[model samples]
Target: MQSPGIPRSREAAPAGWRETADAAIEGGDDPVPSMLTALLRRPATAFSMLAVAVLLGHAAAALLIAQLPRASFGVEAIEDGMIRVTGDDRRYAADAPVAFVGSDGRVRLARVMEDLVPELEPRGSSSEITAIYAERDRIAALLREPGLMLRLPDGRQLPAAVRPGRIETLSSGFWLSFGIALCSSLAGLWALVLRPREWAARMFMLSGLGLALGAITIGALEQVSLATGSRTLFWITHINYLSAYIFGFAIVALFARYPRPLIGKALLAGFAAAQGAIWVMGLLKLDVDMLGIQIFVVLLLALLAVVLAGVQGWLSRYDPALRASFLLIWISLLLSMGLFSIVSLIPQLMGSPDIVPESVSAAAFLLFYLALAVAIARYRLFDLGSWAVNVGLSALVLIAVLAVDLALVLITGGTWTVSLAFLTAAILWLPLRELVLRRAERRRDKRDLLLLRGASEVAFAPRPEQQTVLWSQLLDRQFSPLTIAPVTCDTAAIRADGRILAIPSPLGGTGLVLSYANQGRRLFNSEDRSVATALVALVAEMVDARAAYDRGARAERQRIARDLHDDVGARLMTTLHRGDLETVHADVREAMADMRLIIDGMSDQPRRLSDIVADLRHETVNRLVLARIHAHWPITAIFDDERLVDALQARVLLSVTRELVSNVIRHAGAGTVSIRCALTGNSLLLAVRDDGRGFDVDSDTILGNGLRNTRKRLEELGGSMAVQSGPGGSVIEIGLPLPSREQGMSDRSMAV
Candidate 1:
């Protein structure tokens, strides 16, 4: 069954009823108007409509009062509680009776009819004869001319002529109170209409309604007292108490549910029973003292409930939103209570008149409700840590400001002390607050960075199992989930519990899961989710990179095996079969040199251009001397300024140079060879000229394997090679682009 103030859609109903309703609406029935009519029939909606009507009625009354004529009157003191007034003198008569107008705009006769009393002396009174003669002489002079005599209730005589003006100040206060009640009612209606399903929201609505009803009762009773000069209304006064009790109950209940409920069912039941008992006693007018005792007991219980709520909020460490909301509620309630005590309760307790108007208390209550409403509606439920921190710091600064003001007032006196205190506080407070906040933020940021760094380290772990272990450790340090285990479930669905995060395992599996139970009793927030996402992405990238590295290593080993089998293996076999020691030795040396080149090329270290040039010159000269050929390798500085080349580029350049020199000595039958290296623009230029019989150009001839490989290497390095051949001489020129300036400088620094 749906509650009167709750929506039907929120309550569970018979199967298919909602579906039928939806289908009927969708099939061109135009049920919106009907639906609205049904809504109006609900008790909650009817109550809200009534409240709106009441608000409009009060507004109209205020407008009517504004249209009334203005009246002014002069007041003069004649005696205690007596005044003489004269206005537009033509309106008053000498013998006419006069009246005074009250603040409710009602006028009553100021004169009282009573019998005159003759002065009598007590039998035991000591009367001096000279004093009695003087009093008799004064009385005889006043009796010379007899005029119309009148007496007031207090035995004081009224003035002969007087006038009264309209009184509206108290009327204005009543109207203001009515307006506050109207606003409270409307706010309650809004909360119920928007979120009637939530228990906390319902409690808030009830509190607002109670406050509105109480305000209305108090305002109306006070208004009647002002108009009729009677302040006692037994029935209506009890009704006011009932409304107050209801309001207090709802407020306590709301605190119990908000953030989290701390009180058990038994305590809640006890609270309800106490409130009911207090209400019954107040209604029956039985044992007034008992009623007071019941009220005090309920108050104490309510305070305990609020304290328990704060404790619960603190215990739920991960729910920053709840903690923040509770803190705001605590601050607002204490402030309101303090103001009420100072301005109203304390004065009344001390038998003094109220120093502040009742409207101050009304305003404080409104502020408390408004703050809670904002916190619930606007702040995210689990992600208010930063906001909570800021509010706490701001409160501290405010306290500091107040303390400074008080200290200055004590030391400097009232004469300009307030201004000086404010100035000093502004100068000192802002910088200190900024410094503390910055430091706090820096610490938080550092912690976040550590989480990221830990994840990155896990990404680079050598083994997949090791990565999982490290990832689990990172999660433990950060979130501290209750358990970590593999699950064959959907990895994309991330779930969380109080201080626990359920994330997909980095290792590939449908059911692999890593559950983290956090150390603090807090829930995983959006920030934790973001960090986890980044970690997963990094791990995926690192896994891909590792796979690529392994594949490349395998392919390189195959290429090395093929080169050794096809070149060195064949040459050594031929030399061994021919029984030629010199040929075998030469083949072994060439194989060793080839193996060294391959090893150097596979290394990650870079080589400088000058170093490569020197190595190339030395190797070419030694090869020529061993081959008994005149070599004119006049290669000098390759660059005017020193430059660094990466391993791949350097290997390609050296291989091509060495291959050209070897071809000249072994195949070309050249008597002499000249090598030159230089830089032109951003390109490195190498020229190898040989005085040997050159092959014919544009002929269909298969090039040697070494030449083919050299050409392929130059193409891969984004460079081109040109060959100019003739019977007299042949030249091979290679041009390669240099690295960018910044990269060259970085490499040079590293090399140095």
Candidate 2:
């Protein structure tokens, strides 16, 4: 696709250009006045001026084109010695047709071919023609045939067809005047009565655009039919008319984007979908007709009714922004349609009936653009200010183009001459405009700098002692965003012992500050109040985190204490009962010592109960040896209880703590180790919560034995222990409640 001498891709821009753009956006001082405010005041005036210029230019060009000689088209006939014309731009005259021999030695009917065909066709392509040439009375007979034809040199007949080319001349001045009137009416209505807003303006413009295009196309088609006898242009014109009908709905749908009702949204979506479908069908060569136009019109009218109803409902609710938006939109609709209707009448009055001209569409659009610009500049309609700016700039650029076009037309002698003139005019005008804008900008800059200097001078000026109160009052007045809570400031002053005044915050807290002049000076100079507010929020978050952590820590400690008392104390009491008075005393002392050790060890420790079970399993192996039970410990323990794990881990350990000691004094005759630890849901179980001399667990003495003590301890910790004792060594199981992950709380319910 690249030209032979051109590169496929241009090289990347140097970094300097990017930096300059950034600087422009950020470095501009007082951007509000520089951009937005300036635009709001001057843009409307500029638009109006440009519109006038374009109107003048187009009018001049049209007048010039009109002055050229008119051309004739289609067939001319002689019936009963009277001349009758039946094609486009028909003119009747009595004349005898004669074939003329050209210098090229070809015979031709020069007047009809040159004057008739070119005039009728007029470079307009989408036109149809169905003309016949015969004696006036015979013409009616030829018209009766379905396909009108022309006789060729070979005696063959061909169907009559005219292909109009690019541009067409306006055959009637009245029609042109009618178009001008319609446009003028719309513009006048827009200027005087319509609210200074956007939606109204846009709708007015779009409808005009659609109708104008429709009219132009229709006129071109008529031009073709006048040249060639065919119904093609007529059919194409009808299709265009249908499309224009949809364009009206498109304008209506735009207003639906405003926070409208459900019905409005549905209408908007449905209308858009229909338009899309129509476009797709058109692209696929599906021929739309007058019937299709009727169907779409009915649908659009229904949608419009629904939208208007919704708008009424919204108005009843009384939202000012919505009211403003809807009002503007409706105004646009009325202004455009009302003006269009009036202008459309002119053609009928002038005996050259057709659709309104394209210029009317532009005029309507200008109004719509103005209304929308008002919304963008003030109300931020659709939150689309950026898009509006771009579109506005484009319109301005279009004005410059029109200006260039004017210069080019003035210098027109040939294509090259016109092109050169256009380029030269643009180059000259652009620089001049830029220079004027820069000068205006400099003046604005000077004004802004002077104002800023004044503000800075007032800000930095020296003041007396009395002014400090006035200064604080002023700062408070201007900076209402900082609504500081009242706090007491204690100033240490005029006290022999140097006592500072304590200022209490109104809500709860207090602050102390010296009342010394130096302190006051520093306070006036400081601008770190924002930093203080941020620090307050941060500290609040940290306090919440700490409170949560402390609650968890407290719960953990309580559970551990309960476990130690139940497990270890019971075993120690048993030991004291079995010994003599002195020995019993010694045993008691030893138990007290062990209790102190467990409590001291746990003070700083935050281990979970499951981990303690694993440690207890290994410790129970040594206890078996110490107890001299000389029996198989066969310990397999699992701790899954939340409360019981923390509550009974120490108790479990204490029960096993001196099992080997007791066995040495009583039943354990052997001592190797076999133990395993695991955890499962809902229960913390110790297999060797006991392994000792074989005895009937149900016996009265054994029922109240150390085993009973262990069982009671287990029950207290929300656990149950069972002793399987007979002749072989015993196996004990302590089942305790497990922690619920949810609830995040230990269940201290007694073990069953």
Candidate 3:
């Protein structure tokens, strides 16, 4: 139906259109800057810029990490004013209140928290006021020294060494954070570059950018604090909060206006303005309470608002496609945001240990950005078909295998870890693969059956228009589109963000447009488009077959009409005017014989050429004898095993023989008539010669009805007739094409 990944606004092109549309922006194209316009025009350029920005962000995080001192000392916050040391390469006193003294003789306090910040005690609690901004800056400055002097409770000072390397010193948590940020930003950038001016796309890009910046700040801060026991920098913590607030608001804004606008832009603007104002106030310490549980509560509220906005969006839309797109975004928001919250944010607010590391959970945000890009663009724009499922499953298996290998390395440190991981994954995947394939097979079978039944109904339709009607019905039954109408589209495409599906006609005109699929419950997705495309191709073949059938039917009717007029009518007329009973009986009998031959030919029952020749010769000789004319007909036994002919071909041959003999009997006035039949090459050749006072070949033969009908019948079967009529005699050499055995059988099957 369309290409995979994020597509441009308006779904697809019709005639003259840009891939990236800017009409949706405020003041239309006027508000879009020239530089942004140029970037949009060249997606590669936009991608390069975005990639550079992401790389720079990562580089800053990496550089900062390399600068930080590595204590390699695990710190767990036990309670206020104290900490407990866990696993470390260098053992310290088990119960020691250790303080790090930097080489600069500056002392730093170590406190561990999930976000690399000393947890701000609640205002009403015994802990009271949080650490002042000056104190936080002092702790941050002390941690900046290259290495630190470890001071334990026992008064034993240990010189902890530190090192620096851009990539080598980077921690695992940092990489996870980097991945989450990179993936999130790129997904959003795809949509933004494609549809920069589109509101939905803008909000989507904002959401991704926010997640990326937040992930980088949080990951860098947490990893640095975790490695070197130190308090989280105040500014970095504020940066994380800023990114989080922006991300939350952007999601809320996105859902508010996408699919169906749930709220006005003014309301969305107010939400954004409030976050900005509150963030500035918190940064200046004017609203200390707003920076603590208040921020989490605000984020939670924002998520809930997003859910509500999605619900309203769904309720407000009647178009199934649009609703479906909204639904995907909504569900993705809930799953990705929901998982990130439950495992990270929600737990932090609840004062419970996190279910998973925040860095690992942050990656969930990637799903939302990707989902938003596709849903807003047009959900299911691409039909990767079962291949999408295959790819997902393969990736899952690979991750599982990797996880197993890592686990094996940690648990047993075995050299066969890779082999064991692959073996385990293979064991699990083989059955899973069979199960998936079998399910797919079942679904495909049903679709194939539907196609077969539909094609038959269409191809065998009594009228051309009926075929069109049946074709429409088939599509309607398959997709259950709420609205279906004719549209002028040479090629099938999904348009209006899947509100309209254009399917090209099989009969070479514009096809029907289907909308509101599943009766307003879903959009016209790629699967629907694929089904429609396949049906169109199937119908094209069926239409061609129908046309061929109609042609054959018309030709058959004309052949039957000509046969009735030429042979039977002429015999019946002669029978009516006869005076003698014997002559009249003979005329009726000959007419009945002609009718029998015509019926046999029309019935598609092939007869042996030798038997037909013998029968015709018998009839011709009997007629000649009655007319007092000598008959000398020789049957060539050499041609009995010759090729067979179908009913129509047989009919033509019979008619030719009858017309020639009738001419000799009525007007030839010959003393002797000889008929010779031979099978030459792929033709059955026949010669009827009469030694009678023959008419002029150029004049009388042209006007003779009997000869004319015989020649016409022969020509109809792709046979030929040569009349060498003179004062001596007239000989008609007729050559009708003889069919091969296989072809004759096939033609017989299709004769009707």
TM-scores of the candidates are 0.55, 0.30, 0.66
Please say which candidate is ahead in TM-score: 1 or 3.
Answer: 3
Model 2 regions lying over 4 Å from their true place: 1-157, 161-224, 227-382, 390-615, 623-631, 635-685, 689-752
Q: Rank the candidates by lDDT, best first.
A: 3, 1, 2
**Tens-digit lDDT string for candidate 3 (125-167):** 2123344434444554554556766665666665544433356
Candidate 1 residue spans exceeding 4 A from truth:
1-194, 208-249, 252-371, 374-379, 384-457, 483-522, 526-611, 630-639, 672-676, 689-701, 722-731, 740-743, 746-752
Better of 1 and 2 by TM-score: 1
Residues 338-360, model 2: lDDT tens digits = 34433442333333322334444
Query: Which is better, 2 or 3, measured by TM-score?
Result: 3
Q: Give a tens-digit lDDT track for model 1, residues 1-752.
A: 11133223322221233344345445444678568545543546655676778678666644543332222222222222234442322322223344433334344234311101111110111234224333433332322323312233333333322112133543555666676677776776555554545556677778777777666655544343111211123444556666666777776777676656655657766877777877776545442443344335445544654565566556754553345456565655544444444555454444443444565466655655565554443223234344444544554554455457657756865422456666887898779878987998999899878976886777778877888788778767766655556555433333422123346666565323334324434435557666667666666677777778888799678656655554456546655775657646665676677667778877847777778788877877877777777877664556334677787677677777877776676567788888888888767888999888886645546355666667776886677788888888789999877675466732223221
Write down the worst ten-residue block by lDDT for model 3. 12-21
Task: Say which candidate scores most in TM-score.
Answer: 3
lDDT of each: 0.56, 0.42, 0.67
Which prediction has the highest lDDT against the true structure? 3
TM-score of 1: 0.55
Candidate 2 has its poorest 10 consecutive residues by lDDT at 492-501
